[model samples]
Target chain A: MSTTATLPGGPGRQSGQDILNLVLTVGLLPVLMAIVIIGTSLMSPYFLGWMNVVNILRMASFLAIIACGQAMVIIAGGFDLSVGAVVALASVVTAKAMAAAASAIGGPDILAIVIGIAAGLGSGLAVGLFNGLCVARLKVSGFVVTLGTMSATAGIGLLLTNGIPVYGMPKGFVQAIGRSQILGFPLAIYIALAVVLAMAFVQRRTLFGRYVYAIGGNQEAAVVSGVSIRRHLVGTYVLSGGLAATVGILLTALVGSGQASLGGDAMMLQSIAAAVIGGVSLRGGIGRVEVVAVAALFLTILGNALNLLHIDSRLQPIFLGLIMVLAVALDEFSRRRMSRV
Target chain B: MSDADLAAPAKPAAIDARGSRILQGTGWARQLALPIALVLLLAGFGLADDRVLTTYNLLNIAQQTSYLALFAMAQMVVILTRGFDLSLGPTVSMVSVAAALAMAGIGGADANGIVAVLAAIAAGFALAAACGLFNGVVVSILGVSPLVATLGSMNIAIGVATTISDGRPVQGVPAAFADLFYRGSILGLPIAIVIAILVGGVLAFVLSRTVFGRSLYIIGTNPQAAAVAGIPVKRLLVYAYVLCSALAALGALMMTARTGSGEPNLGGTLSLQSIAAAVVGGTSLAGGRGGVGSAALGALFITILSNGMNLTRIDGYVQMIVLGAIVILGVVLDRLRLDGR
Candidate 1:
């Protein structure tokens, strides 16, 4: 377990460690999925159908999009409880914008889609900025600050529409974005995959990514080394917000309506769980985007398998919770083992 | 020139002393601020709304606050030792639901309600204590970070709670137990309030006057130093978690009594609010500070905020926003005090 006893500089290079960790983390997801597939196939002949696989991918897409941002935030040494709320806000804002646009301009689908994306990004940035200010300037703990933002955003969403679900999106907009597919795959899944790949690239190749890891590894050291800790911190949160908004929009497209209350709540816990399960250290400074993406898939598959097994929907969260704890416990144990050796 | 230089030197000394005095005063005030705020807020609300001052309303507030106060104190104890109990809320819910179910099975009101209640409380404490122990073992012995360890436990606890309740609220609490909450007022004060006050006072004594309490502060300030000084760091951490859970169990009892039912989501708000109250009362998340008196006061302040909003007929969503703002404000004030230190 101890890396120290190995030949000096033998196996500790950045690429080697990254590859090893990535393989281990990403490999687990497929193994879990295969197991689920096999088990479910034995129980029901329709388990391995292409449609079922597509269904799983579609469900995983929205959560995976959100998890990408969450992975970054955790790696940057902060948590964002308000991502869910941001999603809800974004969804509602987009719905209203689309409705208004359709009424005024006879339904320009492209314009409405662009407007939705812009709204999602703007709303996310606003909340992220508020959170960053409170955390950095006011020097509040990230946990408390984010929690406040979470509540406030939820309130904002409720107030905007009096807690009613917003409907009547442009029909063309829904058809093009929500139900459209390319090469037998959902557009949302492809979008999520692209985002995940981009995140992975940023984490591996960008100076900004290095800065994030440096700050998470040691704040004072990063500051002394001339990193703009405040700017980068705020940027990370803004990015998280934007990604959450994207997830929200995708969810709206899938459902063909905007229901603020339900959409955001589950994402908060799920994103966090997925990040942790993927080997992201809650203490920050270590994690991989690919791992988190895999984790999102693992969770989705598990839920899908359980549903197929006729397990109660209510018990799903409980099972997910248990798995989350187990993952962290294992991570903790491995970390300790590595440190001791 | 010699006289002026001498006077300037004296001025610097005077300023230094005054600065130190201010720091000390802020520390002292910070400790008492939450309690003072609680009292003042209650009084202000009582004045603004005549009904707020009435015995009925006051008792009602007390009853509502007791459950939160218990959870807050539990959170305070763990945080004082530089740990967290994310599982506290779920533990309470799980125990309350189990108790309610047990009572329902035991012929409603007359089927040995006392034993069933005690058993439920014990089960809650035992479960919470075990979680704390798991966290302690991982954190203190295995060198896992508290944030990661507890986040994992939070998920597991939530899962267990959900599984136990099967996603349904447990109704049909024993009549006698319900009456103890709804009808058992003494001298116009709710019995629950008396229980909370008693719990607060007793815990206050234990925390302030006992050797174990002092040791917890030592552990919180510097775990390595405490371990070196033979403070039994692992044991104390476990103890802190156990006490936190036990108190949460007591809170569960009161909550069950008051609501006359137990829901899986019973303690959702309590988790964050308890931490908020503890922090507002000057219990630093960094650990090694604060007392139960301030925590109780913090709880009272929160209650006042909610109750006042209710009386004013403030929009529920706006009230949530206000509460979030208050939390941020409290954290900001705390940060300022810490920076001065």
Candidate 2:
């Protein structure tokens, strides 16, 4: 919001310098992405294979879905570290609820799955709303608030499952929908793409999206201009929570079980990395959903490339860390350059 | 959910400013709040188990608390300057692996083994210091946000550690290495405890009696004002991060020695736990308002709660939930103090 607001642009107008700047900054992700893909294909026979592409997209879809919410939260001037934890929590609760509903009420698999998903998403929203209340009402910093929720929510999930993977989800859920493919691609790919497109629509052409950008871009002006900072911030958190739960439930279905440690697998950092790489301003009020999806895709492909190249998987975080730092550093420098101008 | 790296901008106090107040907390801070809570926890746990109050168990708690105390101090130092060091935990993990791998490279434990241990310690400290330096430069010189800078460093350190150890614990260090740093006693106190006390004492003195400490608070409160007063803001921030990382490394090294191995995953929960301790102990996330004393108290409180819960056979997941709740409670308590004022 801040960056684009200062730039000379309207919806159908093109300026040479703006295009150049966009290409250099946000546009660079796709360029790097192409280079990675081509370079990996050259280096490894398996890189461009059909199976690998599907697998990469499936992985990217999960991250992209969660990161969409992350980007929204960032655009609204808040951060939710608990997104990953929400994933795990949702997974656990969904499985638990699905199992309980099936046994207690003797319901059909579809009903059980629906119950599980609702339970999962409901818990996620509860966690998000709770975090929002703490941040908005109690005025705790978002980091600390979400940090606490991350632990507490995840702990609750783990406690419910006793540190074990929850398995009682119906078999058909995994077979028919969870692992199903459509048009030679995994169903997750379609779901992810749909989510990305919908979010892009909401972010670009919706009143709520405008309010979020206004809030993050300038809170003082937002307040003066009649935006309910608290309400909007809480609403953003709810959406983030809901998305994280979606990932959790989807991953649970994919794995055919709910594992409490899913979120601990560095999911939080990766989600944030996706958002940052997509050019979501840390100061808030700046981002593009389509760009974020690309960022997530690039990250998945990069990891796949490393694996295909026989790089030690243990050292993967180094690449992620370097890229994240570089992206952030670039953002800072660009912002400084713009502010100077 | 981790450390300083993910601490989003906006202090709890600065967020809402006014309106919400649960109660008027007494005293300049309700100074007795943390201590009273500590006493209640200790007493409750002691009553739940006869062995809890034993000198042996008390010593055990002290030894464990020492590490957390060290980490809390490290976090406090950075938070004092409006900086976050999520990398502290990873620094510990990376340093542990580096130190262990370095020591493992040397053959048998002989007269030369003493020199080998010193060399291992140096290697660990060097790696930790290097990480700190990188975080400092990125945040201050490059104008990157502290959260992202430290987050990147965290992942990088974790990657290096995993690379060195192949994601497993590195073994085969000399028994004497553990003896000198962790097992050996100074006047019947664990060496780790003694070292923690000495470090805390020195830090307390430095923070209270030095120009650097004063400048840190000044810079944290208002960078512009500090610059106008001729404070070398960037350098001091760098120093704070370096100090934070180094201190965390010391704690990690001690724990690594005690385990007689370098654990690549050693830093997993330390980030959240240390931040929890710091905030609970009364260190302000807003910066410019916390010290070693409060951080130590926070660590002590957390340690006691965990140890007591263990003594009474409480689940680890429950501990995580309660610990996370304490972090939020601490902030709410902080706000209440402000409201009281």
Candidate 3:
């Protein structure tokens, strides 16, 4: 089997429909982002400021991180819906761990933070392991498995904290993560950028990446062709879990505490929306990490702009819904065009 | 005839006659699993708490499961066609808010109460059906995955709900409205329970007897085959979604009545809960199997689980964990049964 089966309309003889498909698939998101930026800047002076731009990137950092993991899972023919809960669980665990470590060890800060972070991430991985085992080994649909995990994880988070926020991490640690800057930008931005780049490299250059695409493209074919489908599928979910945990840790720093509902309903939905808007196909087998990063930025900027515009936060889902539908419709339009040929 | 058989590759069995007999029995086993589980749970809970199996509690369970039963049936309709309505919760929310608004605004004490209730219900159902129409067009005509498409619809519905109600419950509905629609009984049973049974009975009849319902099975099992067989796949898909959303709306009406107001924030756990109920009842996520009766039983199982836990003084968080575990266990058992066959 071919290692990289090209998507439809692979630079062959040109047709109008093919051109449209290519543009819709590849060019629409960036164009949409630029339009939003320019349009919003014209409406509000603060929208175009460097500070606001950096803030938008900073605001999107957590979502971008989660979306990167979600992108990998989607590319591998499964997706995680428990990410938002995982983030909350991770946050709570991290905060609790940090507090316990600080109290026990008298905080040189770094040691306590390190241990705390590990504990938080460990919790996340545990959740992922359960999801991965059920989805990959048991052959359960990822949707149902993750749906169950989401509720369970959220319940676990709430149980641990008694529905309250954990507080009092080391001030130094919080400052470093939440407010420390590199030159003019937040550390969160740099971290998100690093994640995006690393994921892009892994997606484009690694054998596991190739396996993911192959499995998503055709699971039976991938299995027949010597791919370790179960292992890779589980790995994708683990990656998602770990990344969501990382986001949880970041959220702890940013808020200076951990709450059971850290990311809330909108967070998971936003990550998925970002992935979809950036041209990640829900059916799997096709996506780029770089595009997903852009998609996350697009969503963040849209939300920020709307905030600046004084739009009701409650109405935000409507715009998100409309954009999501439009994006999928574009995907459909492109697929139809390719199939017609 | 079944999705599993259609999707299963031709592999020789490695089992003996006894094993084959067990495998042959798996089909009906899967059908009976949820009901049997429900019975075992009821017995267990009854043994634990005398109040758990009392007539009052039984009636309470029926009343509580009524809305969930409606939601499960809605999900089952689309699941039967290999589609999902993630928007069902939001649709319910929107319908509830709309119904509440109508009841509060249009159905004053001076107004004709019956006519006002009828008009409000008509409007509520119309909005819900429209939501389904949008989802259907996106999934069928546009060919988007049901997950992404309905997720978008969910966002839109939520937005509408929040906007219309301004994030508050529409209150002061006529007391008689709540009495008739929510608390009032027909033949010594809650009207909500009566409505739920009627809906389930009608759906069960239609699913088994109607061409439209049978077409869902064919389409879900293998869309390509159905298309080749000249089913109007796209139109039928639309109809399925519309039906699903309409049923959700009906559930929303019950919810609104029960609350004695239209609550914009309703449906927090509903979408997942409905899916959980459906899956637990033995409905296939892969589609082309299961029925309304099974889904209703699933809803009953879930409601009883919650109610029993409450009676046993289980923490709400623990209940959440158990509910999540049950969904995963249900799917795991389902997979094992399918693999056995």
Candidate 4:
């Protein structure tokens, strides 16, 4: 483990090999984003427009938020397939609570909004708790646990709304959070940016983050070194669940209704793709949130650009899939090159 | 003194041997948790609704479970090697489209009747196998993680499926084809059920008795150890993916037959369903410890649950919740069994 200076815990160095891997991992996203920008600009005159760019940014914000959480989970050597379902659950719960609150108060009250948000976010927290306990305590695989939770939560969401969208959210709240722009961009972009920055800091400078990398790098080593694997692993999942819930609420605002199937499975898939394209290893313990943010933008832009070019929306997944495979291949190539050196 | 003393000692030894045999039986019982639950469920549902135990309902379950049984086999094979193929669902969708297009004529809606139907079925399997080959190459040769590699392929397959089918369902298949594969029955058994049983039996034999099967378990248990022991780990893994995809393709064709149309969106639930069935059947997500028979049994169990729910007029959403809970419960039980050992 020490031989690979590319590891986060390795001794500080300006080694050439280390620098190469860093460039491949951290620098790849921006280069790809630039290429996408240039290509899209060439393909469509509207691609370079500020309005279009902002539109892409706003859309990418939701994905970026989810990807940020997913990046942490991946770095901690875990995967969460239930984030999409958590989003739906949060959306329905929040919308339902807020609707009831609005009716009792004869309008949307501040207290009602607070209660609604808490209930929504708490639902997410509960899901995380269950997943964390099962994975960490019962020792179940994260993939299986999350897959089960995803389906179960989605079912709960559907039951809450009976497949109907909950309408009648306060118009002011929707406009303020979902429709209105702040500082030339939607509120969601700012929230996503804040999350990215905070998570990046946590990953770089916090003991919890260090423990996550350690656990992912080598669980036995981490345990031998007195790190609490269960705590960190469970915490990572909880954080991911919270973030997914936030996205769900944001989606509700954007859509002006509480949808039981908001985001669905596509959101989870895109989040994983964005994180991978940003150089997060599915093998775990190596990624940067900043790059993930850019990757999220690139993915969102790629889809938007395809739509602008009049390509069928159904064909969009193919490009995203191609990019994911290529990105992982590049990551693998870099890792191999580093090892050889 | 010699005869009497010797007889007394032998009697105690025989008793000890019987005691140990009972303990071994309990171990087997632990492994049969899912099966036991299935039997209990059947008894309860049958008691509640006499129709559930009727020949027609039982046959319906057999027919319904056939596709999932095939999928579970495919998933079990891959999981046996500690790999996942998330693209299985999309592969089915793509194969469905390919077969439909072939039957609908390459260019126009002109069916060549029997020849075209046979050719279309063959084309579907070939396409599915090709998709599996792609997954294998990416995972084994490129060394990408199975999760990411299969995910990328899934997106690509889904895109291709929707594009080729023009996002619409193709319905030009001859009625005779569907009848033979789906509706036809022999000895009061649906052909689909017969095919599933035959395939399951063959796969179970291969996994238990073949060198290839043993190699897969060895690699899945510990790849480095398997490599050191002279197994061609990479090649076997590739074969596993290919086999999995081929099985998925067969399921896809069955789905097309059952639905009597080629749907671009068919099998959206397949990846999850297959994984659930495999896991429920005691196939460890960690790999190396499951058989084809268990997987088929698991599929039957799931089918029975669904069929029972429908018969009892249980809400679909509630059924989803129950099924999801069952997946988690199965995994938890498996974990407990392992820990006990």
Residue B66, candidate 1: alpha-carbon lDDT: 78
* lDDT, candidates in the order shown: 0.76, 0.84, 0.86, 0.85
Candidate 4 residue-wise lDDT, A1-341, digit = tens: 34564455534544655665666756666766777788879989999899998889988999999999888889878899999999999999998998888778874466667767788899988898889889999989888899999989999999989999998667766877788888788899999999999999999999998888888888999999999999999998999899999999898888988998797899999998988998888777888889898899989988888899888888888888988998898889877877887
What is candidate 4's fraction of native contacts?
0.79
Candidate number achieving the greatest lDDT relative to the actual structure: 3
What is the Å distance of residue A94 in model 1 from its true position? Answer: 1.1
Model 2 has an lDDT value of: 0.84
Model 3 root mean square deviation, Cα atoms? 5.3
lDDT of 4 by residue, B1-341 (tens): 11111112212475346435534543655756677788999999998888999987887887888889899999999998999889999998999989988887743344436777787888998888788888898999999999999999999999999999998999887776787678788787788888888888788667765778777877877899989989988888889999999998888888898898899989799898999998887777887767776678788888999999999889999988998898999899778866764
Categorize the docking of model 3: medium
Task: Give per-residue CA lDDT, model 3, range B87-196, as digits (tens).
Answer: 99888889998887887776565554776687678879999989999999999988889999999989999999999999998886676677777878888888998999
Q: Tell me the tens digit of each residue's lDDT in model 3 across A1-341.
A: 12123545544634665655456656678767877888888899998788888889898888899999999899888989999999999999999999999999994999999989999999999998889989899999999999889988999999999999999799877899988999989899899999999999998899998899999889999999999999999999999999999999988898899889897567998989988888888888999988898899899999999999889999988998998989888877867766775
Q: Please give, for residues A1-341, the per-residue lDDT of candidate 1 as tens digits.
A: 34533536554575676664654445445555677768887986555689988998998888888888888888888888888999898888888777777667765577766776677678877888888777666767887788888888888888888888888787776787789999999899899989999999999899889899998889899999999988888878888888988877887887888767755657887888888888888888999988898899888888888888898775676577656766676566656555676
Least well predicted 10-residue stretch by lDDT in candidate 2 chain A: A11-20
Per-candidate TM equals 0.88, 0.91, 0.93, 0.91
Q: B131-160 in candidate 2: lDDT tens per residue?
A: 999999999999988888988988899889
DockQ of each candidate, alpha-carbon based: 0.47, 0.70, 0.79, 0.70
Look at candidate 2 and give me any clashing residue pairs: A1-A285, B5-B147
Sort by lDDT, top down from the best:
3, 4, 2, 1
Colliding residue pairs in candidate 4: none
The residue ranges of model 4 lying beyond 4 angstroms of the native Cα positions read: A1-27, A106-108, B1-26, B106-112
Worst 10 residues of 3 chain A by lDDT: A1-10
